[model samples]
Target: MVRQTLTKHPWWKIGVIYQIYPRSFQDSDADGVGDLAGIEARLDYLANFGIDAIWLSPIYPSPMADFGYDVADYCDIDPMFGDLDAFDRLLDGVHSRGLKLLLDFVPNHSSDQHPWFIESRSSRESPKRDWYIWRDPLPGGGPPNNWISDFGGSSWQWDAATGQYYLHAFLKEQPDLNWRNPDLREAMMAVLRFWFDRGVDGFRIDVLWHIVKDVAFRNNPINPMWTPNVTERDRLIQRYSTDQPEAHEITAEFRALADSYGDRVLVGEICLPNDRLACWYGTEDHPQVHLPFNFQLMETAWDAVTLRKTISDYEASLPSFGWPNWVIGSHDAPRIAAKIGEAQARIAAMLLLTLRGTPTLYQGDEIGIGEVQIPPNRVRDPQDLRQPDLGIGRDRSRTPIPWNSSAQAGFSTVEPWLPLNEDWRERNVAAQDQDDNSILSLYRSLLALRRSHNALSIGDLTLVDAADDVLAYRRQRANEILLIALNLSDEPRPLLLPENTCIAKVLCSTKPIRPISSTLDPNEGLVLELKEKS
Candidate 1:
């Protein structure tokens, strides 16, 4: 068994968090697109599963260029998702179920169609022209810098009318804001205050580390192992465009706004690897984001040692200011069930919840949903069509949720915005609702177990032993001690237990297990409660 420990904090103790990608979650009107009302109507199901909060991916008004990530209006709801009243209802519904709601805040960029950007681009002398990053072309008619967009091609989009190239790290339609401009920063803060004043619980900031760019607009060096077709931005080292020092300052401002409300939180999405990722939490003088979404579980290789090392390294690297978090699935990545196979998805979920940090669950993962195989002819994402060799087919993971066996998978009267998976008839919420052994049921039980025991909620993570494919750990807080063990292979493995302790099998993804007499079968996982001798 490998041992680890965590500092006890309020937000870090959250039991279970559910991520809702608005477009594919549900459709309230037969329009075949999900709206805020759709989520409100489904609140009971989420609450029933014992989820503590729901992270709603960007729902702000957008042109649908990059779904809702390209914000046209930071304060208003998009017609595709619904109006203000619908979101108000959503908050009421979520709160009624004892759950909190988190909105996606895209602070790094705004849609070119946004009012501020439109005015900025209309003329050089416009008041809002400073809102975006615009620079003149080099002498040879090339871009001023060699920054590459995350979606491929040059990060600069040349504007013929102004004879300048505007910086856009993602899409040309979404212009990167000039964080060096204090006016723009103040405006973004006002937007956050506006939402908070309206009672928003918190925000899950999008690409929070990409807020500031290298001041000199210098060219990024070519990566030694750079390959054009593999990653979206692998051609360059991205030294000048991401994870700038000003990012921490911006995050501190965001955290302060959210901290105004005692229970509010801010979760940042920093995609960099773990070594430098922990710095986003800020230093002792200021607190950065509440929970920086750690993607180690999603990025780690599917091996016992790799996963164990990732978790252990994160625990060791966490700064004294902010809490640690773990995410196995999200909107932009493939489903966890598909990544590790259906049998192992439950085990992954078990480990995520039983571990030391806050756990985030992507929507539709509870019932063993995998990434759908979308054919090239039916591909919808521009990224997939634009760069076929990249194999960044996200539509496979963004398919509409399978609520029931009904036509359209109970998602809409018309065809969904994205195609529903063909296997939805058999693998859906309706079918799993009645089966205790189903993944959804297992998730519900896991949430209940985590909440009922303080040890599981906010306890220290101490690895007892780790050998081959078997790993064991203890979660302790005061008198409660919870030992979690996993048999990560097909063959049976013997696990060493704590001496003079009575083992009580509290939860397991497979068959009911006892500590000594019962052996964990292949892909079997367990959470055992321990009682010390008098």
Candidate 2:
């Protein structure tokens, strides 16, 4: 059997992070929206669920444009969610359960209603005018450049009073901050200190690569491979708009500030290719982020060969000092069960927990909740409304988590802000908690196994040859070796063990009954202790 041993790795390096979309987790009041107290009430459930840390999406003061991404006040809590006292109580509860708390930091933009943005737009000579990007309109009475907003339309919005246009990478109400401004940078850095002082373990920096843009405000080159099916924002290469070199300087500064607060971690949300993403890690002497949030798994095709290459390529791209991270589902992406089948999602979970990095699990995914369709009248996402053709609305994935079969799926006393899945009654945590064969049970088993096996965490990973439909890898630490084999296809596949190696024991599996032979059931995954043939 795989043996457990102690390691000196930080919690962020070896721990499993559970992402909580606060608005949809639970509701203490009957306001149809979740609150901090609701989250505190569920602390026992999360503790027992076996996560090392909890990362909450933004709960700061906002106008609700883009949910809480557009922060109005960086230090204060939104009245809708709770007051400062409620947040303090929640933090205490999380610490009491020995779970780290990570808050989402949105430094790229602030709501138009923010005081800084309000003053910036008030006059050309306002002290904070340069806090946001503003430029004179083109001589031909058009936007200064051809940059497009991620939501849709022009990235530049005209201000009739100032006879200028301000850049907004997303909705017009969410104005991009000028990270180039020294004063603005320092001010945003203070926001980090404020949270660090509150004992927050770390932050998940949103859109870390979009913090700086090309100084010239030049038009992005048109994409040669643009297709009608893709979003309009992808029509251009975005070379001049995002992933700029100067952004690394800002990330480095963030790392410096976070380092001052001992044991704190910085996780950046950078959506770039593996090579480009690796740059965010900086060098061993000048590290930027603890983790750059690898998202290749979320975008790659769910097949053995493709996934195997994706993992190997990512591993090859990382710097020696950079620790890896994996994310399969998030508030912004479709649910794993919706993207792949429920059976494959189980296999996906095995892959996530067993991989050689910190894994982040989205709320409700443990219970196998899929995407919930939002009706036309109830649509809430601005992205879906602005770019209806792209169908990139996130409302389906951000639906309320189903806790039970009661009204509103036990998420709220009243109707939740978003709809719940139709199968919530049968696919909820309460229902699955009682079923041994449920996906929730499999997740619990996987998490428990991960906690007990040193080979699964902080171990070296080597890809093992396997059948065409089966993806296999061996995770080893010293004398301990555990092989993970995943059947990516819908049909049973033969497990091809490495030469001179035999399965000594089944440590854990996606199915209720562990297989004893060299055959994998449809969409089954197994973690087996390997031994050399005597």
Candidate 3:
């Protein structure tokens, strides 16, 4: 019997999202890797943080080539992470706390170990031969195109047995799917339904923009000035390879599928500028995604001026069909705590929770966990495997979470899958939970304040004049207006206040904001409320 699942609508407005990288988050089996049970046991901790949902990274059947990104099976949880029953139990627990479960959907490619890819590469006339992109060798015997992999080297890999080149935008072992094929589209949707039926809330579509490519096999133009940081693939403009016009339609299809399930949401990882980023939201009549993960704040230099400009730019560029969101840290980049320092991580958390959008807090960022220092011999990321000199491994941010001050920081009974940070004694969750002034406590207070005030969550944002090292903005809902000011520099700084509004009270401050204070100390930021002058 075919079970029809309906779409879930307006799912983003309810609460804060906490991202969990399951493999590094916890390990119940003490196998050195985190599993679903580990996360299940920690639900109470997350629920206490005022998080409305959990966005778990891929736990699907995989060879761990990309740490679950290269999925071998979309419908089943990997044995390393536990079975389907464990995932079901985790979902049940999350729901019991009124929390939603968002899973990572690697729509761009599949591990070569996947049955579809294995069958696709078996023979030229195999039944599933066209499931993945395959091309004949160029007239001169090299790859058919000049496209390069994001991980490094040519994007096309030749299968000696098949005498054809296959497309892999990432690691060679992960082949790009042929999304241009309708059969493949239906099959992928079936994977989505498999989870939807399992009571999952939604998905964080990984590398969503790379899902489709130009079918013409055209060569991409070369960049005029290729920075060393730019990948060999990024040397080209990516004109034909990404941001395809058809992507919007595909997103709409996904939106429609998610809509088939009541209140399910779609959040896409769109790496683009504000203007281009807003386009993924679909046309006014039909919305592509509830929120396209906004990384502008994460990439921008941490400064009042830069942050103010980014906020204004993103707000101005938001499409009518979509909502705005802000992400300061994620598993792929440097930790925010490391990026801005411990004091600044607290300030950033304050700013994140108080902002007017759904906020996503990366797993370890709450406790101010900085990036771990991994030596050359221990790097596990594919990016580092390809370019060691660049110091680009994301595993620095993927270090195991410090649950408590125990052997292996209470994450595992034995040595962890990755080296434990030597400083876990000071950074463990137990230490922070007991300290009233800790980052974890600050996050709790900030989230609670935001949840208590609708003006902070869904209100309209208005920028105010703030001097260098100071950022000031107002969030307004109906007649209630809340003004927030942050001093982003060391030592004290003065900010220009809006006219006609008397200072009602200081909503939040890293340190006490002195009356008529002109400067905020290093790492200090504050939220102020304005009173209507009688």
Candidate 4:
């Protein structure tokens, strides 16, 4: 059956999103960091790349404790990145190029250095004492509960002056805000309006699921499946500390606020199982986020059988009004090429773009950049420093983008905040743009195909029966039908066509040359037009 496209579909529903880690994208000034002006300079590159919107990581005033995630001032731009004028210019450039811009909205926490937090911790009777989550210690003067921070150790920090323990889901330097406080909620909502008034398109809300916590401050249950392989935070199930039912009310409020500014989109960063994740969409009568970011592709096993089931399960778990979005990599995760080999990364790219939903492409993935090896002295991530044994540092994937085969990969005039990929000299954008068979060229082709075909961008997906190593799916929209078959194994696999279906044309392939037969080469993927026998 043909899936009907919404008559008034927003740009976000039909458009592709490209996520840019601001510190790694480009540097306009000689400084070692990327700034808003640097992003403005790269507008032409992104505009021509066929992305509908750009989702930038946090660039607000911060102390760099958590690399901008610990926001000091939500309503202002960071001096290290740029001033408000620079941000305005960047937004102007993005909108002029017909591209939307999304800022990283971090409402769950703020830097301990923030004025509000400073006052909240000044004394027990401070005016803003209830602005942040603070509670008296247990009878023995320990933490209030057994909850653990995402970084490590306890989720609470002792405030000697206030004689209380404050909650911090991340580092101790970043304190969680009290969403239960009506004043705090109003203040955060004003931050959103501030951006909206300045012409900002929308936001990607960070840790949307952690906005509201359990009121009782109960201890988390012990995780039976915890092991030495994972980080210490997984020792408990986090049942009470996160994904509270009240969080939905905040999302609904956010949705209403965004609706007032017609055409604005809200993308939530939520990490949960498919069933629970679907709940973020709210009911048909009261929609929440436009898209709840899905990271299943990054977390799932890379085999065909596993991926096929993952995709099907996610599709089945979505609410009737919930729109699906996919992510293969992010600043917090390893690159696709690093997780899988370069060859399989190409196949994964094809799978990502062909799926029946919005796709968010991480910067530098188009050139097949792998994870850079970060030295101990250069590590900037607190997650890695606190838990070195777990190897959870994200610096490897947060390296600078290689624009040309020059010193520092043309990302900055000085040394970059993070190291560039080792092969930056050869695998840069300039070099790849000149090679017809390069990964960049394949991405360009795939994006162009997706833009031209309705069956790819907004079509109904059907899983086609295939061997264990081959993931085959059909996308159909009225008379248009496209078959995507990906060989996930190291050996060649024959295409298993469905009953009475025939290949009409080979539109694109991951290999340098298009496949001429039904057999797909190792780690290859193909997009083919299909027809039914008379």
Query: What would the TM-scores of all predictions be?
Result: 0.96, 0.98, 0.96, 0.98
Q: How much is the lDDT of residue 277 in candidate 1?
A: 86
Q: For residues 1-534, could you state the per-residue lDDT of candidate 4 as single tens digits?
A: 222455677788778899999999999897889888888998998877788899999999999999999999999999988999999999999999889999999989999999999999988888899999999999987999999999989999998877889999999999999999999999999999999999989999999998889999989999999998898889999899999999999999999999999999999999999989999998998989989999999999999889999999999999888888998989999999999989999998999999989999999999999868998899999999989889788999899999998888889999999888999999898999899889998988888887788899888999999876999999998999999999999998888887898989888989977646778888889999999988
Colliding residue pairs in candidate 2: none
**lDDT of candidate 2 over 1-534, digit per residue (tens):** 222546577888778999999999999988999889999999999999888899999999999989999899999999989999999999999999889999999999999999999999999999999999999988878999999998879999999988899999999999999999999999999999999999999999999899999999989999999998878898898999999999998899999999999999999999999999999999988889999999988999999999999999999999998899999999999999999989999999999999999999999899988768899888999999987777788999898889999988899889888888989888888999999899998888888888888888788999989998899999998888899999999898999888999988998888877557879998889999999999
Over the stretch 61-91, how does candidate 3's per-residue lDDT look in tens digits?
Answer: 9998899999999999899999999998999
Residue 461, candidate 1: Cα error in Å is 0.3
Count of backbone clashes for each model?
A: 10, 0, 16, 0
How close to the true structure is residue 362 of candidate 2, measured as C-alpha lDDT? 95
User: Looking at model 2, which ten-residue stretch has the lowest summed lDDT?
Assistant: 1-10
Whole-model lDDT for model 1 versus the true structure? 0.83
Reference-based lDDT, residue 469, model 3: 85
Using TM-score, rank the candidates from best to worst. Answer: 2, 4, 3, 1
Determine the C-alpha RMSD for candidate 4 after optimal superposition of all C-alphas. 2.1
Q: Determine the backbone clash count of candidate 2.
A: 0
lDDT of 4 at 338: 95
Residue 165 in model 3: lDDT: 92
- The TM-score of predicted model 4 comes to 0.98
Query: Could you tell me which 10 consecutive residues in candidate 4 have the lowest summed lDDT?
Result: 1-10
User: What is the C-alpha local distance difference test score of each model?
Assistant: 0.83, 0.92, 0.85, 0.91
Best by lDDT: 2
